[model samples]
Target: MPASELSVRPLTVADMTRFIEVDNIAFIEGPYSPDLVAWQRRFLEVERSIGLFDDEEQVGGATIFTMRLSVPDGRLVPLAGVSWVSVLPTHRRRGGLTKLMRHQLHDLHDRQAEPLAGLTASHPGIYGRFGYGRPTQSVTLTVPREHNTLRLPQGVDDVTLRLVSPKAGLEACRETYARRLTSRPGMIDRPDFWFDFETDDLDQLRGGQSKLRLVLAEREGVTVGYAMYRTNELGPAKGEVRVNDVYAVDPAAYAALWRMLLNIDLTIATVVPGLAVDDPLLAMLEASRYGEPALRDGLYVRLVDVDRALAARTYATPIDVVFEVTDEFCPWNAGRWRLVGDEKGATCTRTDSTADISIDVRELASIYLGGVTLRSLAAANQVTEHTIGSVRAASTAFASDVQPWLSTGF
Candidate 1:
């Protein structure tokens, strides 16, 4: 099939039904239920959605949600949360996805609504070409129930835990999440509809596990943390617990909730997903038990408005350097810019000074959160240094006191 025959455009209200149909076909999900369709419309906007049409029939589509993304130093910025990206099987290899991505990036840049665009990638091979870099890596843990005892904190002993229904505990979970997002880089503030989506569950969606359960951690009757999970019966006397999400405001609260989930009765092992690279649970655990830690890409980010995105976060040290950035997809970012800053503030401006270093915008985004360093990127040939010691100086300035972590999936 020729790419020229397919046309991509923003969706209209009347085009939504077909848009959803093509999305389902592309993703291989069955026709969405009427109730689910209504729920989607409540949060998703038709104008913000785009579809690839083949002779007036929708064949591919994607949408973005307005999100508040936290950066280092507890600052928040608008982020375009890209989601539901798919193209029909017949449209594969026809440049359908490539066209959609090109259009989406241009739209984001033109609107100037967000300084960054981000998504959770279903396939790792895609997105890098568009200058999106994976900045955070997550770990999956399956700890046996026997060794799951958390090394208790003195304050945690005062914290209490209890199981509550999802509906009953929604506010507590949302409140804890609201605070956690500010403290952690790469976390996104959940909107009202997102809260509803996370809490609502159907049996089929549970993978034969028990209904979703909510466990809350509190101190002096004030909620500080919560964990959402489910248990599955694998045998007559043994089973496994799968943790869907967890958040906490205090160290003790976090430890307490993990302790409760780890000790859930009748479960031989507990599966925990999206643990930060430096998550405290790693130190509290007695042993690896039956599970091995595996790294998973957490979030892919693109600096749509590079100038604003660079200035939004605080730097670790004071340094100045001219950066020649190559952005093939977003050419507006392709130029030499001087960035100067420290912990107090930073600024990125167009410059004609002799270039100290050169890198792709993707490399810059990967190191933006301070997770990846210029030295490491240079070692991999992903970054080029034109001046002696510039890599070390730039890396030192960009280093983060706390590693970036993204717990939210989308």
Candidate 2:
């Protein structure tokens, strides 16, 4: 088919089966079922979505979801999240993916969205071209069989930790997560996030459809911590337990959650977390050897609109700086804007702004989740400094103490 023959448009209900087929071919996995495709289509129809087709054959697709991002002072800012991007293999290098992304970003801009987009990248290298960058790093730690020395804290006695059905435990999990997500940066939740906490298919388990057990740590009949985990045998006497996610409001509860999962009867070793960059789980263990941490990329964020994205996040310190942002794909974000921050909050506005810093849209995304610093990017030449003092102050203010972590992948 000729390039001009291809067309891009909003996905419809009738395209469900073809969408699933295209996605499976694109991802090289069979996780997307017809029902899942239908659900996704419905979700897209209700939200902002786009698709590209080559003569009736689905080639690419992307969806955007809304989230209320909580700033430092307990203010919730509306955010537009992008996810589930895919392009058919045969359509690679044909600009199908780029076209779909551009359409989605333009749609987001028209909706008065602040141009914040988040997704878990299938291929880390692919998104930078579209002005997306890694905002957070995920650490996967593996505990050796001989180093399993996790113990429950003293005075944490009388607390009971038991496995419960995902269905029975949905409300508790939601309650525990709600508290965590609000206080933390780079975390977002939607109303339907807890709709179905359990599913029968293994492939759909990531979205709550797995045989994994939910362990709730209860003290005085109140749940404080919870972990979703599953154990499988790698070989005889060699078992692996993977923790999907574990959260606790207090130290004792945190320790108790780890103890219960580490001591799961048949498992000799455990991979207990998908931790944030600053997770203390490694230091909490008896020895660092007990938890060998491995780093991997997590969430990929893009600033659809620089001003909106800058104003949406709460700064850690009071500072002022101007950024000359360049975006080739989304031209609306390509300009200079003055960003002001103080103990009160932060705001971005257009001005005859004299820039203290300059960077591409990609670098801005890298710093959006508070993981990467402007100074570091500046040092690497990804960001250029005009006024050193102002640049340093602004960068420091945007930095977050708690490293970003996405509890769930798109």
Candidate 3:
């Protein structure tokens, strides 16, 4: 509780070693591979990485990654991705975490570069007070190899499957990835380094698992899909095929990629991790124990510039209403605003008219991606409807047909 612990400053690449040490300690996970740390250090934006120091011994730190996030109607909005947030155990409850967040929020509001700020919360409850809401959810499917038999769509026989080195298959894999990027809401843009990180495939980084493998799906000699995976074995009898990601163009290609993994010899189960809530696999298999999936929060979004975040996306229907939004954390957004336009486009501006709905900015974040609806939040009393018929009208306008998903983690 001394004044020395109150010191805060931006972190440079040079400070990343100490930063990661304090960070991994806080997370209780890693002394990550040196290769990974080096790549991560280079990927950092020094000016945006804030650190709380106690006489140069780092006590806490957090940083924002500058990226673009896909929103409704295929619009890409600027995203300030909050990552690596941590406060050392020795410094717990001294307000180090609070200082780190307060500094980051004020910085985001002041800079105005990214209209939205987001994070994958280590603890879901920590960021709501900072005006962040759970806008996206990710699901994982674990199917017993025997139960992996899916009633797949037609055209599986027409697709050609090939196994190649990760390096050899990069071109085809990236092509398939590009096609899926902007199709759904909540996808963050991946830079070159992200690709490197995902496919690094080093033996040292494999831990106890097998080497990373690549499988490409081709049709008429053109690549249509790909999967990056590895198999984990428990002695000679039990094995699990762990798939990192799978992307495909058509139902056939999708089926073929999954079928290949499902049929892996001796594997007890096929583990498909990090997928959209409405992932095709969920619909492919019958309702049974095979598709046992775990659901959890993925991305948390906070609107730094409420107006820009609202105006940049397309709405599903038409609605004109004023929202009385509260954000004591970022006070600039705490005001009544009128939004007009929908489907084709929309605009939101400050207004003096009475509010149609009153909601906290965090709740507003929930519905922003069209993943969660105003009606649902209102049902839980998280969103308050003041005008007659406003809840149904606004919910209809803000919703998207497909669920929002973000596969990449910050």
Candidate 4:
């Protein structure tokens, strides 16, 4: 196919059913139901949806959730949440994905809508060429019920654990979620639709597991944390508790929630799809007896506007460093820049000074959230340090105690 063969345009509401159909086709998943499409309508608005057409036939499409994300300093900034991205298998390697990605980035940059764009990648290598970087990671864990004893805190039992209907406890859960948003680097300032957050009980999503169950952790008659999970009881010795989402403000509440989750009768193990790399649960659990922790990809971030993205978040240490950033997909960012800041605040601006470090924009994105370090990238030969000891200073400024963790997919 020629480069000029296909055109990009905003898809109409009429294309939604086929839009979903194409996603299912590209992913090679089982057939989708009308209920699936209907439920997705809460977030995937037609206005935000765009598609690639090969002479009037829609071959691929994607959508964006205009939202905000919390950074290292407990501050929230504009975030373009990209999701539902897919291209037909027949259109593979024909420059289709590049076109889609470029169109979206250009639109954001042109309009100055969002400084950062983030996504949960289906495949690890697909998005990096477009200036995206893996900034956060998760771990898959299966903890057996037998040896899942938690090191309890002094006040854990004081926190009351209440099992409420998911719908009944949603307000309390959402409030608990909101309190922890600014504490973590990658937590989203969730949209209204997402308050339901993984509580949907549709049959297509359950995979034969029981409907979502809600547990609220309360201290002093106030909500401190929440955990939503489902149970899979297929046969003898086959029961499992699947923790779809969980959050807390402190050790006691977290331990209380886990103690309840781990002891759910008849479940062989507790399966968690995404656990933060440094989650406290790991330290509290006697899990080595039955589970082997496995690493998994979490969030990928792209800095659409390098200067704006850099200055938006505060630094940990006082430092001055110049970065020679190469962003081929977004050429406006491909130049030398100066970043200066202290523990209080920071600023990044275009500069003509000699570069202290030379790096690709994608690598810069990885360090943007402070989840991955520049010195580590330098060791891997991904970041170039031209000035002696500059990487050490810059990496120290970029350090964060929160440690980035994306609690949910877009």
Model 2, range 133-222, lDDT digits (tens) per residue?
Answer: 887887777886667675446655666897888778888887887877765566667546433523232456454323677888898889
lDDT of 4 by residue, 1-410 (tens): 44547667998888887888888898888877787877777668788789988888889988999888888888898999998898898887777888899999999999988999999998898899999998898888889877898888789988998889988988887888898889888888888878774666777877788888998998898898999989998688679999977888888999999888888887888897887788888888865446678889888999999999998888988889999999999999999999998878888999999999999999999998888999999999999999999999999888788678887787
lDDT of each: 0.84, 0.73, 0.85, 0.87
Q: What TM value does model 1 have? A: 0.96
- lDDT for model 1: 0.84
lDDT of 3 at 89: 87
Best candidate, TM-score-wise? Answer: 4
Q: How does candidate 4 fare on TM-score?
A: 0.96
What TM-score would every model get versus the actual structure?
A: 0.96, 0.91, 0.95, 0.96
Clashes of each: 0, 4, 0, 0
For residue 364, give model 3's deviation from the true position in Å.
Answer: 0.5
Span of ten consecutive residues with least summed lDDT in model 1: 198-207
The CA-based lDDT of model 4 is what? 0.87
Better of 2 and 4 by TM-score: 4
In angstroms, the error of model 1 at 250 is 1.6
RMSD per prediction, one decimal? 1.7, 2.8, 1.7, 1.6
As for lDDT, the candidate ahead, 1 or 4, is: 4
